[model samples]
Target: MKNHSGHDMAGHNGHGGARPGGLSVSENGYTLEFDSTIFSAGAQTVTFRVTGPDGRPVTEYTPEHEKELHLIAVRRDTAGFQHVHPVMDEKGTWSTVVTLEPGDWRFFADIHPAGHDGTMTLGIDASVAGPYDPRPIPEATGIARIGEYTVALGGELLPGEASELTLTVSRNGRPVTDLQPYLGAYGHLVALRVGDLGYLHVHPEGAPGDGSTEPGPEVTFMAAAPSGGTYRFYLDFQHNDVVRTAEFTVRTTAVPRPDTAPGTAPGHTNHHHAHH
Candidate 1:
């Protein structure tokens, strides 16, 4: 069940047979229920809950990544991405304050019910009422800068195969060596496909205190694109006791077809179209 307001959006997560998470509002008898689908344009508190198959609010969950639930909010145009944890009340209601601009937004709840086999990602859309001017999706780039910090992305995203991607962090042209641990890892990555906002939450290659993982300079992860398309990546890393996010726009290399001629594989292309 899709849970957006009357305003219709584009894209339906067209890709390979395997469907990515966050495109549906309910899965496996669990549903994400929002109190309202409209809010004021600014910092506002939103309340929601998760209902089980019995139609009762779920109060128990298995903590993953050091949090009972992870809340991800992003505009439809792939802007204003935020990863936060909300406070759940005793009655199973969760509330969190999110800064919203005048545009359409998608909110995802990543949780593992007490008896579920694995984690499930449920998504819903809401609108911030006002005059909206959506921003175009940023071009494909490997480097992202935020507040004197530079993050360089290495490796490519291969369709239907695991590709190793490395991110090196530096500040003021110097390598950051004393990175602190956040959410039981040195970094947390969230990749969202440009069109449908298909979500992939990935962790680094190694954890802290594992004896082989260092605290600085480079963090690695293996990511696989569901299909050949453009994707937006958000990396949340901690250094100097502050958590900051670095964003990157990447396009995956298309897979070759057996019947196609040699050297006729789809090449790397940059998309400059405005997202609706």
Candidate 2:
């Protein structure tokens, strides 16, 4: 087993902490390691191993979310999305074989602790060692309907920076607010970078002041892309026992200079871009 230094784990600016809420990445800053040099023409098998926070082995850990671990792998550009369950071997190693195309990618291990409601996000980056033209970002398509509660998405992203996104939702041409709460939060937003589908879980900032409730015909969120690329977004909202999803396309601009506003166009406040 390879050992990783403490500083290596601290270097990730993607998430606020390497180990938030007792969840830590493996020594190499990734929960899993893969042999990227090999690939098969059609259906190929790629093997990977999972490591624990102790930098040793992760054997017999507790299960959460109805599974020991929920693993999601996606190409950085949203080309592929896979939800997989890895087999935990007795030696504290979790292994899985996935057939992948030649491209750069990322993997996320969503681990839930036993008897705890919290889930840890552990991840790593890897690629199929070969050369292939990446697929272009698919056109932004999908309609946000009242009952569906989910949207189709498209966009681009930049790493280490925050981007502001505004989503407007209406039913039959009328603004829809009074959205009820779902999953203990006002809304659930999921973002995936287009090529690798690097996942960004986002939450909306609630209304200011205590015990105040506000629904929306418009919802705004701040999201930081994990890397620079095209991305797809899915926003899920609920009302009257019905869920609705709104999808949008976004392309993250390159990081600006320190003097420039992060999410603004040259000399313009991003607030002007509001969707309401």
Best by TM-score: 1
Q: Each model's C-alpha lDDT?
A: 0.80, 0.51
Where is model 2 poorest over a 10-residue stretch in terms of lDDT?
1-10
TM-scores of all candidate predictions against the true structure: 0.87, 0.50
| Candidate 1 per-residue lDDT over residues 238-265, each given as its tens digit | 9988999999999975665344356432
Evaluate residue 131 in candidate 1 and report its C-alpha lDDT on the 0 to 100 scale: 97
Candidate 1 ranges with C-alpha deviation above 4 Å: 1-17, 257-276
lDDT of 2 by residue, 203-238 (tens): 554542236545766565555554445657667677
lDDT of 2: 0.51
Minimal lDDT window, size 10, model 1? 1-10
